[model samples]
Target: MADLFVSETQLPVEVRTHEALSTEELMVFGQSGVKEFEIARRFEAGRAGFPQSDECALAFFEISGRTRTVIREDRLAGGAGQPITYLGFPPARAAARRLTGQGVVSANSETTCLSRVDRAA
Candidate 1:
């Protein structure tokens, strides 16, 4: 079971190889730990408001592996919808201790639910 993790794209592309942006390139985004080889847009062009530039973060998840089912459905710091793509494959799920090296000095209860690795092990 692959998990996914995402955070604000405040670093260089080298930092977040998963980052994808809309045609305008202002509304930047990235994803981590996905199983689906590809995901089609659920909505059409102009179907939803275009994604924004200043909003903070985006998250993606794999709904199932049965049919390459990865859902780009997201939780944003503020807004939604832009260009999209299936970012190849992540080496592992959200099991990583850190997302782009922000900080891991502390771990919360919610963090356990997100990590695939058993830290206690």
Candidate 2:
């Protein structure tokens, strides 16, 4: 299984790869531990709008390293708009290639959970 790590500094721009189309088993890792799957964006979620907020963050999912899925924890109303926190699937290194034309950086082997979204904040 391919595994990678992205820091808060390397803001996610786009996800270009995925493991499989099956959502039967998917888990999102975040600071709060296992995060419930809120909603899956369009299959071509990558083609959607780019995360315009600088406050965007990065999240790691402990699923197939093949599926490079991207999920965002929305921000709360009236609060400072934060960057779209993206939950990248396993082996998210491909994101670099899509985000930037340059090659993807080696991610940390350790997989850290994503921070919980403060929608009520």
Candidate 3:
């Protein structure tokens, strides 16, 4: 399975290429060795009315024959969106993550935003 490793600080994307392991495997060398910490930080920030920056640095790694290679690196900018007015239900977060992942995978040119609005029943 493909895994994504994210860090607030820069990751050594170049040097890591020589290691014969997937990004998930490399996690064992880190302090936490778990990716959930970053996910939690994002959720916590959202809960506290702080939205994450729209920009992200992404590096795609893939296996070519017997070696893993960094195929592409790019910045994902979601652009500015309206301020978060109301927090949606728990499922909203999952939906947001799914949509964002799709954007990253497709390298979409357009930005998408999610907002919650209550309508009369």
Candidate 4:
């Protein structure tokens, strides 16, 4: 196999890129070893009002019928990076509530997620 390498300081984001009629999307690697899909904002990089926060929303649904989320803090430039704990958000919390609350999941089934976009008028 060819050598696969990336800089040590950089993180490898696992993703599947897609372009649909409605929107572009990315299925990124999230918590619990499952996928947590989100709307693509690569085109908005370096823009003032980019959706960077939503990209870090790591929520997961597991076969054990439990859901959890990890919200990472913005990394500081000078110090050794520490992953800030996940704080609750509407999408993450709602998904967690689905798995643990009244909503249900089956072992054989896969968890499906949609990238709900935030638009400006």
Tens digit of per-residue lDDT, candidate 2, span 1-121: 1113544333222331222222322233221212211111211132122222211212222222233343443346634444443344433334323323333232233222112222222
Model 2 misplacement above 4 A: 1-65, 68-96, 100-113, 116-121
Q: List the residue pairs that clash in candidate 1.
A: none
Candidate 1 local lDDT, residue 8: 32
- Write down the lDDT that model 3 would get: 0.27
What's the true lDDT of residue 81 in model 4?
41
Residue lDDT tens for model 1, 3-46: 24333343223323322433223112323223111111111111
> How many clashing residue pairs are found in candidate 3?
0
Predicted candidate 4 versus true structure: per-residue lDDT over 1-121, tens digit per residue: 0112322233223222222212322233234322232221221121222243322222232221232333333466734444533333233344334444533432232222223333220
Predicted candidate 3 versus true structure: per-residue lDDT over 1-121, tens digit per residue: 1123333333333323423333334335422211222222322234222233222111111101112222223334633432222122122234235435766332222122112101110
lDDT of each prediction vs. the true structure? 0.25, 0.27, 0.27, 0.29
Off by over 4 Å in 1: 1-20, 24-60, 63-92, 95-121
Between which residue pairs do clashes occur in model 4? 71-86
lDDT of 4: 0.29
Candidate 1 weakest ten by summed lDDT? 36-45
Q: Report the Cα lDDT for candidate 2.
A: 0.27
Residue-level error in angstroms, candidate 2, position 4: 22
